[model samples]
Target: MAKSPYPVINPGGGPMGKVIIALVLIAIVTLVIKYPSDAARWVHGLGSVIDGLVDFFRTLFG
Candidate 1:
């Protein structure tokens, strides 16, 4: 038998994985829609934390 030329999407998980991913996406969408301001603030705070980490690493190694 010949191997597939196309790439496989699922890494071999069953339908449960697809269902869980779909549910998580739906929940995220719901939260964003229900709390737009909170979501924006949370994202901004996350970006700040990531930026701080980058600065810390730069000082540590550079």
Candidate 2:
């Protein structure tokens, strides 16, 4: 029996799925790297995105 190289649970998943995630992460990272504003803006944007989820959950629970 020839064992299939095709993964049942793909480590990369599909091409599009990986690409979309990579792009979003890249966008945020690029914002950090090349923003015209101060470091505060970059830090705030990154912090907000990460904290946004937590704030949402707090509001939902509260």
**Which candidate gets the maximum lDDT versus the true structure?**
1
TM-score of 1: 0.74
Best by TM-score: 1
Cα lDDT tens digits, model 2, 1-62, are 99888847556678977888899999877876787476577678989898999999999999
TM-score of each: 0.74, 0.39
Q: Model 1: per-residue lDDT, tens digit, 1-62?
A: 99889977766479978888899999989989999999899999999999999999999999
- Segments of candidate 1 deviating more than 4 angstroms: 1-12
In every candidate, how many clashes are there?
0, 0
- What 10-residue stretch in candidate 1 is worst by lDDT? 4-13
Q: How accurate is candidate 2 locally (lDDT)?
A: 0.81
C-alpha lDDT score of every prediction, in listed order: 0.92, 0.81
